[model samples]
Target: MPRAKRKRASSENSTEPAAKAGDKEVEKTVTSGAITPKNKSAQKTGEPEEYAHWLLKSEPESRMDKGIDMKFGIEDLKSQPNQTACWDGVRNYQARNFMRKMKTGQKAFFYHSNCKEPGVAGVVEIVKEAYTDHTQFDPKNPHYDSSSSRDNPRWFMVDVQFVRMLNRFIPLAELKQIHLKHKASGGPLKNMALFTRARLSVQPLTQEEFDFIVSLEDVKA
Candidate 1:
């Protein structure tokens, strides 16, 4: 399992509930952001549906995890068997819950984090929805949680299939400028989870924000 950078303020290994760990603010923000209009429509119609969009982060630089290299980028995902891999090792309760909300066939931006020029590099589709994360049960796994059990797993993961790289790599620096600009003018990305919850490895994106960001690929910075 790839080891995600501990950009989170709390210890990644902590299994306490988000409320107990003083994460109510983050949980509240993520909960609101994760609620896509599509989901509401599905609920109103009594039909199954997927989230509008999401963003997943992984470190591109080498980081050892129990003697295994933990570096995983968009290209690494593209080379996997069937160009798919389990998005495991997420320990944050807020992030884990977001994964659980994902439905198959949903799309997500593959963002490079903890690396030089970190930014959204590509897209991926959720091939499999939430399931128990096996790494949490393995003693040798860096993400192992002795508190979790097979019967009542504490972590979950989804399987994502590579879609395609963005036409242009959107750098984080450029995104920050856009975020700041939009925040002042009531633009689409003003409340984007990517900027509001910078430390979260997995974040939700409203349909408008997703589309707006994708449109940037063709625009000159």
Candidate 2:
């Protein structure tokens, strides 16, 4: 069974649940990836809906993951593993569009880069809509820039709320295993965009890819 996670108040800088209000819900949209809002909405409804998928990269060595932030003159973030952090620092235009296009409830694959066993680590959701990336305005921050004004922001970002952490690492080796097996049967292994384009930083996953990923058991003892 999936563990029940506690939703924290937004004021505490935690990820709040999606607003279910009909008026507030923005139309589901995907501006960058191949998936389109119209198709995704149809999928949401009874009309043969297609799944919209995306891949997000985070460096475990960096302060991106709240779980490993003890060395930053702060307490261990292990207790609050599901804390939602602002995903900023994206400079690429394609990446920024993906961030801007992300809609609430969109599923994302959290991949840990710059790590020994870099691969899909867990799942996350776009709980909040895209907004201006604040880091671009901060001069002290490495991601800061003098060109981006408040009125004309150069970057954008989305809020990702942690869903659940897989018990075991979904190693890249395992993904390769699946590919080889599929290829042997004359099946297409092209579903995984991550494998084809290593430096995309931001990419979409198809519904088929999303289902195959979730189907992997954690293999807990």
Candidate 3:
């Protein structure tokens, strides 16, 4: 992706009080205007524009209503089977950060984990931006926490709508092959969140990689 343009700020008005790790201090920083390639001739000749993609991990059974049984519960399922749902239940800070970064319309890979066949099973679209995850406030909920107060909640979630299930499971091993191929082709999968141990759920995907993965379901199936 092209770096955003930066602009210099006048010294007289540049200083401002900034918060750092719980302390306030005066810091001088430059203000930059939105940056992008100024001239097409100077831009990379064959680069696709950046579009965000995400992978959302869920233990399908946990998400379903109690007493309902299925490979995955219907109540937990996206209403249209292609509709979006607020991806609540995340308790980790890093996962919350990724959710906060996601914008509406961003794509997500729905990965079913801790199940019989853990893999990318379907596609979803971000339908809502990050918001306080209400489940965290419910004292009876398993995700509830004494540390998370209404005034200073520590958890967040975003809405994701279902797209379509892959015709066949995109197995973990298959994803590895796709990841390697993407790396060789100089794509975003080279630095994918799925490859990072700390980020097992709610990951970003590039548009190119999204198309590539979906295409696999159509080949000679």
Q: Pick the candidate with the highest TM-score.
A: 1
Candidates' C-alpha lDDT: 0.73, 0.55, 0.54
Deviation (Å) of 93 in candidate 3? 1.2
As for candidate 2, its clashing pairs are 43-49, 53-205
**Which of candidates 1 and 3 is the stronger one according to TM-score?**
1
Whichever of 1 and 2 has more TM-score, that candidate is 1
Model 3 residue-pair collision total: 8
lDDT of 1 at 171: 85
| Per-residue alpha-carbon lDDT of candidate 3 for residues 1-221, written as tens digits (9 for 90 to 100) | 11111100000101111112111111111011111366342154332233387777665443233332222322255543345455666655545555777778777787766455556788777777888777678775555667788998767777666667778767666776666887788664665556643233555566766777778777652
Give the Cα-based TM-score of candidate 1 against the true structure.
0.80
Task: Provide the lowest-lDDT 10-residue window in model 3.
Answer: 4-13
Give candidate 2's error at residue 203 in angstroms.
1.8
TM-score of each: 0.80, 0.65, 0.65
lDDT by residue (106-180, candidate 1, tens digit) is 899998876667788989998888888888898976777898899988778888889999999998889889889
Task: Report the Cα lDDT for residue 75, model 3.
Answer: 25
Stretches > 4 Å off in candidate 1? 1-50
Q: Is candidate 1 or candidate 2 better by lDDT?
A: 1
